[model samples]
Target: MDVTSFWLAGRPATGDETFSVTNPYDGRVVGEVAVPTEAQVEEAVAAADAVRAQAAALPVHVRAEALAHVSRRLAERSEEIARLITAENGKPLLWARAEVNRAVSVFRFAAEEARRWSPTTQRLDTDPGGAGRLAYVSRVPKGPVLGIAPFNFPLNLTAHKVAPAIAVGAPIVVKPAPATPLSALVLGEILAETDLPAGMVSVLPVPNDRAPALVDDPRLPVVSFTGSVPVGWAIRERAPRKHVTLELGGNAAAVVLADADLDWAATRIGLFSNYQAGQSCIAVQRVYVDRGVYEAFVPKLVEAVGSLVTGDPWDGATQVGPLVSTDAAERVESWVNEAVAAGAKVLTGGTRDGAVYAPTVLADVPADAKVLREEVFGPVLVVQPVDGVDEAFAQVNDSSFGLQAGVFTRSLDVAFRAHRELNVGGVIIGDVPSYRADQMPYGGVKDSGVGREGLHSAMSDYTEEKVMVLTGIDL
Candidate 1:
């Protein structure tokens, strides 16, 4: 199956060569997609530009209505989209279906947010009592936006950026990851069916190297990117004028205290720690176990992690699926091996087959290792012993990446201290680091990302503030 031919507008551009989408489970070629060339990207951008004039001219109400129509259509076609996500991205079918639901919710919330957008009113005085003036702040559209979505949560992340831009009357050019472009392409089809008009929302599957051109293009007024930190920074430097919203990589930490319930903590951490094969941005990358419970926690945690069934995501019984690609799988494996070579003990699951690395757990991982310091982007966790809560908090705050962190604790003071000093944007009281809500402010501090994402916050990012002033009024 090939989706490159499914470009939303302009001529269908496919190379003589096709890029294969390999099933990470067995390295089988499940489908082939078109490799878009520079010319194709130009055409797609042109098409989006053609629609930009009309889309920007439309009343905000019209855009909201179009988005509402899209939301309804998406809900109706949720199952089909979910199946495509499963086939293309290799996530569990159940999780894929949940993601589709979340995508639709994002659209719905974005539409509501757009409908409620209004400028703030303020009083301004030009002179004391004699010459008075009134003023207010108005928000204007930021024009066309480019949404570069990653493979992990393709449909939802795309929706988070694209839906709001369209709702607020900005044309969007979406470039989905090559491995998981199917569902996003399907979303484009649904958006096309709405009154969105031609060129308003263009979905193109472009090669990785050619993506910079789309960001560098002067036509785009804003760019919302979700991917690695290096690429995000590169785009920031290259697209100097465009407004940027980046959700970059993170090395999330989860701290388990000495007094915490071992059974409950072990089960919940095991469940959430490996969700989506541990491919999520906020998934726990480092676990700082208090020395009091280190030995006791290791065996139970290892047993829980090892018991997980790693196989096809489509299979209902498969708790852990393959990583996104063989390269990613190998990267995770090599990191674990290096750690073990450096005297880190493998508590359980130090193995890999094709793109499926078993739910791996490591103890005594050094703070400098890539697996502990950087975003692993796989189903692996590193365990380290901390003297106490303060040392654990210090270790968690030691990294440059701080998206979210977690603490399994009973004391309110410890939880509050973790919240105050963990150096992360979010701190979960009794959960792992894999927590996120579409309605809350979501982003990281330091190098993790630039701005916040949730429904309202995203809307704010895509707009500009202009203060309208009035002078020379008789008192």
Candidate 2:
């Protein structure tokens, strides 16, 4: 019976029609959100357009101060925010708290980046013809941005969109995933307390049908989306004129080389592959092990996965919780069943109950199997043995999605080779692909994503560079 309203035009706005926000754990109604009509979506966009210049006109220090204030306020209510994330997204309480912490860091990074925002000055005297001239390359906001985020990691992902826009002084309209809009709405509530201009930030929880209004709108000059490939690409196609940054799905892989520390690889891989029910974009999905250490690594991986506690997300001891919905769990079960039918061996943990799927580990799965090739966005991991590092690298590169790949090797040469040869956005050394620092340049190659999403990278994406030249400058 908790009722949440959309943050629209600097205030809370509600509609007559409302939708139930259910807890994925026990199918209980946790809250209700007002669903906006298409007209309201248009109004929100116009409001954001009206204030784009106001946002851009704000001084850098003021924007930085505002972001810093939000960061401190979020820290004060970290527990409440964590519980909100757990309630809607089905993420474990520990993971939810970590997400909040990362969000706070994101804002802090934005605050720092905002204060340091400046143009690069290039001395034109490098060439004789360029004597007594100076060129300044500076970035400007790309008008209003349309941020479409996914249900997984709702708070941090929304922060990834909003913080950068705030850092660069661009107005942003966030369309959080309908299933988990409460977190974003709460963030909007906090933002309203800041000194930001009216309509600089708006969180609209509308149906998917009305999403086209936000995506295809001509006024919004930039679109930043993080979600599935099909939807992300469709948004790009529809908004062909806008500056689009798509962070899509990935079937991430990791290689365990012959020289790797088997215990280290086994323990890290097991924990990451099943973390948050494997809902993350870069969660370790496919692990390729060198045949020399396959036997020693498999048992340890199986044992690690088997030890995870799966149940209610509210439990402090629970490591794995239910997926976003029962349908998501069923899809994961069916994919595992399909893989098994194609001669795959289930090493351990392949079962589903309601929306809860046990952490599954598979071996010898066919390369064409859906579980191996596609983004099995569930708690499933596939283990394939290879004769050597070359074969393992090939297997990792064989996927259509290449967000990130991890190579565990003590040899510096092998690490360099993997770093150079892997067709992924990032190559992790001595760990799993699930490892991500909040401030790194994070995105994928191929279908994984289109642009980088670290604080600085995202600020760059939300801005456009212009060159200012002085023809008669004395040094």
Candidate 3:
């Protein structure tokens, strides 16, 4: 395979040293990528800082057209990009295709939001003290952004950071996860093709150890991170003065109320629990079914999990594939063993084969097992029986990570109650916690992190409001 160049200030550049990205499935070297030198990283940062004013002053149409161009190009080259995602990230082909499509929509939405950007006017003459005054308020870019992306949805997650920064006129420096940086480099290549300013974007595969200096740099005032709980919080604490947004994963729960369609619930839970090899932050890690339906639901869920096909990711029909590495699979296997030792019974699938762990289910789990209390980050899920809705909601809220939760129910009142009672970023009423639209408001409370994602929401996160008061306005 040819060497993949990192994007430095919208141009491809190679560094002194290179690293190989190997396929997690078979341990074959898929491609080699250049690691950015410290000097190269500094140059990229300085360029972004120097072009901050120019990037912030670009015309809305210029930003919109640039974003639209990227969206169109991604749609045109969907298959090639999807294959690359599967090759390095070990996700199945179908899901890789879905990720590319989601990224396409993300840029499209950013373009629309750029066109719709406008200031709001409010009259400040309600009382005689503020006669003939009007306040015009607009949200402006805070500063240059530092986006740190994770490996699970490498393409789309990076897009979530870069697209919004571009739409809102914020120059951004991206550090893609070292494990899966090829897709992001490809995205940077596409961004380079746009007519936007040169310093608007940079994709650098910086090592994890050297990321703190970027976070602490005052030039980049905003940091957007999506990864594990400890790392996300460490970034925030390290840069307490910067505007930080975290989309950390959680031990997401799926609540199956007694009134839910049991079969549909079982199928969705099974599929999402293991999708993307269960590396997703919102993947279903916990399940709480009403005791009235627990006996009926467990068998169907087991059958659904058993029917899923797992093998090489390049195959078109594979529903599950390897984890990102054998190390990740081993960690998952250890967690499952620990859960079983603590008296949790495996309803199905408690085996590992190299880098792939079988989609496993557990029942009668204690509340404190690592598989139940913490993020398993694997294809393992723990299920428990709840006596009622109150108990189910309580169990879902019990986690320190309150990212998102799924509740299966058909009743309108129960849906409203779930919306009101669940302490999470999003409440999916009829599906699993893994269901996320690229254009909706997303993020979590508590340990799950701060701020929101999606087109308009992320734009707001990258900007702060500025008020201009005109005192000579006539009433």
Higher-TM-score candidate among 2 and 3?
A: 3
Candidate 2 residue spans exceeding 4 A from truth: none
What TM-score would you give candidate 2 relative to the actual structure? 0.98
Flag the better candidate by TM-score, 1 or 3. 3
Better candidate by TM-score, 1 or 2: 2
lDDT of each: 0.81, 0.91, 0.94
Residues 1-475, model 3: lDDT tens digits: 6789999999999999999998899999988999999999999999999999999899999999999999999999999999989988999998999999999999999999999988899998898878999999999999999999999999999999999999999999999999999999999999999998888899999899989989988999999999999999999999999999999979999999889999999999999999998999999999999999999999999999989998889899999999999999999999889878989899888999999999999987877889999999999988889999999999999989999999999988988999999999999999999999988999999999999999999999999999999998887
List of clashing residue pairs for candidate 2 = none
Tens digits of per-residue lDDT, candidate 1, 117-220, equal 87786666534652477777877677788999999987998888888788777778888898888777778777767776677777777778888778889888
TM-scores for all candidates: the values are: 0.92, 0.98, 0.99
Ranking by lDDT: 3, 2, 1
**Pairs with steric clashes in candidate 1:** none
lDDT of 2 by residue, 274-305 (tens): 88899999889999998888988999999999
Whole-structure CA lDDT of model 3: 0.94
In model 1, what lDDT does residue 66 have? 80
For all the candidates, what are their Cα RMSDs to the real structure? 2.5, 1.1, 0.8
